[model samples]
Target: MKDKIILKVETAGTRVDAYLASCLKEYSRGYFQRLIDMGHVLVNSQKTASSCRLKEGDEIEIIIVNKENKIKPENIPLEIVYEDKDIIVVNKRPGLVVHPACGHPEGTLVNALAGHFKGKFVPYLVHRLDKDTSGVMVVAKNEKVKASLVKQFQNRTISKEYIAAVGGNVSENEGRIEAPLGRSHQDRRKIVVGPLAKKMAITEFKVLSRHSGYTVVAAHPITGRTHQIRSHFAFIGHPVLGDETYGGPLKIGEKSFERQFLHAHKLSFTHPSKAKKVEFSAKLPKDMAWLSKKH
Candidate 1:
């Protein structure tokens, strides 16, 4: 299917690609630039360069060509928390990959969503939870909703809370970890607390309960980063239990865990279409809940 978008420029001097990206928040400037290069974008009925400056009242047209989706829909079950015309909230289960990747080409959440919404609408991911992390997640039903949600994430207006079972006793009732995180030089796959192309990562946490060898803490990541909570806790010598990559023990006492003890417990953000604040919570899975009952 091909969709055409036409816009009349209100502000002048902005580049065509930039203007289009701003107007159609769902697409990126680079994407618009590619369209311009392919002669799919036009200004006043004439093909134009991506860098061409726009004038007030200039009529711009964008032709979006949809390609055949290669990802097949699978009838995988999902724990849907809430759904509406614009978005779907789900309590993502552990060990489920959110999106398809190199080794994980199918059986993903996206594929399942496709199956669920088959013939209705395509699901657009605004944010992601790790493959092993179980928690509240939201998916947009359309590009307009996706753009609004993406903007909220970019502005850090979306609030998130996580429950983590980490090794060792946390001395303080609450504390903040303000550290920079970047990809490890030695391991491209690993993220670490360092200055190598670093971006500031901050995590504020409160000790919820203390157990024999571990502590369950409520973590609020002030700034999102790759593995921010795991990396920050590991930096403080308190790697999350079951996180082998971060030095966490696979077994704590008699119980064993197959994945890291991190759960996205709560998420809050402004509703894209409602223009109202909304929040969602996911109950702790059996494994994580098991730790809370222990003395």
Candidate 2:
């Protein structure tokens, strides 16, 4: 099925990337602009630019191509923590793309899952973390479990927790970050907070450990906005380590690690099949594990 979204400009003086960033929570800024450049975005039913300024009363239409990439299944090993008839939980490693997309069509977890299950078992994503981020991910085996899990997420019933290595030594031991994040017009690749952005979003963070120049943090996001944790953390001037898109330089000396120092450490929700509360966790990857041990 063809996916789509319609947005009405609620406020004036907003740029195209900003407006769409507020509307398209699941898509990245670059992805949305690609849509605009490809003639998939209609300003009052006409194509527009990524930087086109918007005023109140402009209607925007966005067509989304969910079919990202055609990844073939490979016999890659998975860190499966839990599995049942309805659900399977995995510790997704960094650099493993969660789904298929045009930008990254091959070597994705979806293809591997498809191959693992083949025809007898089907796995649909209940939720997804970023490609550079690692941690616990839930996959639903059947439609009922998928629908229920999605509802739980939409209703904010599920609690998501993450761990990350930030760039600087954190001053706050514990605090909340409330930011209205929207996409950037200048870069068309980063997320920035703005007025009239969208509904309220909150992230609670605690300093798990502090080191000489870096700190490990635990993040609890009350709202699951796209790149919420990463964007909010970046706004606070402590972007995740190895996060290139969010002002991170190319990582070095961390051959044991790749991408960002982020992991989906925990997910808590109810099991749809057994009707019991369930919480799953993934151990820190080898690199982080080594670092933690050394520290």
lDDT of 2 by residue, 87-184 (tens): 88999998897765335545777767766765456566767787778899999987688889989998999999998888777899999999887766
Among all windows of 10 consecutive residues in model 2, the one with the lowest summed lDDT is 248-257
**126-237 per-residue lDDT for model 1 (tens digits):** 7778789899999998889988998888899999999999999999999999989887768655679876656998999999899788998999998888788999999999
Mark the regions of model 2 whose C-alpha exceeds 4 Å error after superposition: 1-71, 249-258
Every model's TM-score: 0.78, 0.73
Q: What local distance difference test score does each model get?
A: 0.84, 0.76
Local lDDT at 221 for model 1: 94
